[model samples]
Target: MDLNLRHAILSNISDNDQSQLEATIVDAIQSGEEKMLPGLGVLFELIWQQSNEQEKQEMIEALEQGVKSATAGS
Candidate 1:
């Protein structure tokens, strides 16, 4: 059984307005619930799929720096 979680998530939110999408993302992130992680991952996947090389590089650098900062803090 190949369950398509990302497809389901995207279908669920595809009709949302910009403000709704913003709220969904903000609430999901702020709640820090494990359940929200998959939704966030789907959002990130969509963003990655849409981004060009420069944007992707910037994202990668930010993620690297963020991990470094977090590890340092820990």
Candidate 2:
């Protein structure tokens, strides 16, 4: 079994510049489709793996706020 989903996803976007990467992430998230989850998970994994402690905390805070706001608005 040779499944390398993360590598495949990364390789597909390796040549993308910062703006392109941002657009890719934003589009995937904004679409709100279940099929887009794997790519988003890969992106999130990369971000988490590369972030420092403070950055991780900030991300967690932002995620908490987003969840709270989303639920409250519903």
Candidate 1 lDDT, tens digit per residue, 1-74? 12598778989999999999999999998999999999998888888999999999999999999999989957
- For every candidate, C-alpha RMSD to the true structure in Å: 1.9, 2.4
Could you estimate the TM-score for every candidate?
Answer: 0.87, 0.83
How does each model score on lDDT?
0.90, 0.89
Q: Deviation in angstroms for 38 in model 2?
A: 0.9
Could you tell me which 10 consecutive residues in candidate 2 have the lowest summed lDDT?
A: 1-10
Q: Where does candidate 2 stray beyond 4 Å?
A: 1-3
Q: Which runs in model 1 stand beyond 4 Å of their true positions?
A: none
State the local distance difference test value for candidate 2.
0.89
lDDT of 2 by residue, 1-74 (tens): 12497788889899999999999989998999987788888888889999999999999999999999989957
Quote model 1's TM-score. Answer: 0.87
Top candidate, metric lDDT? 1
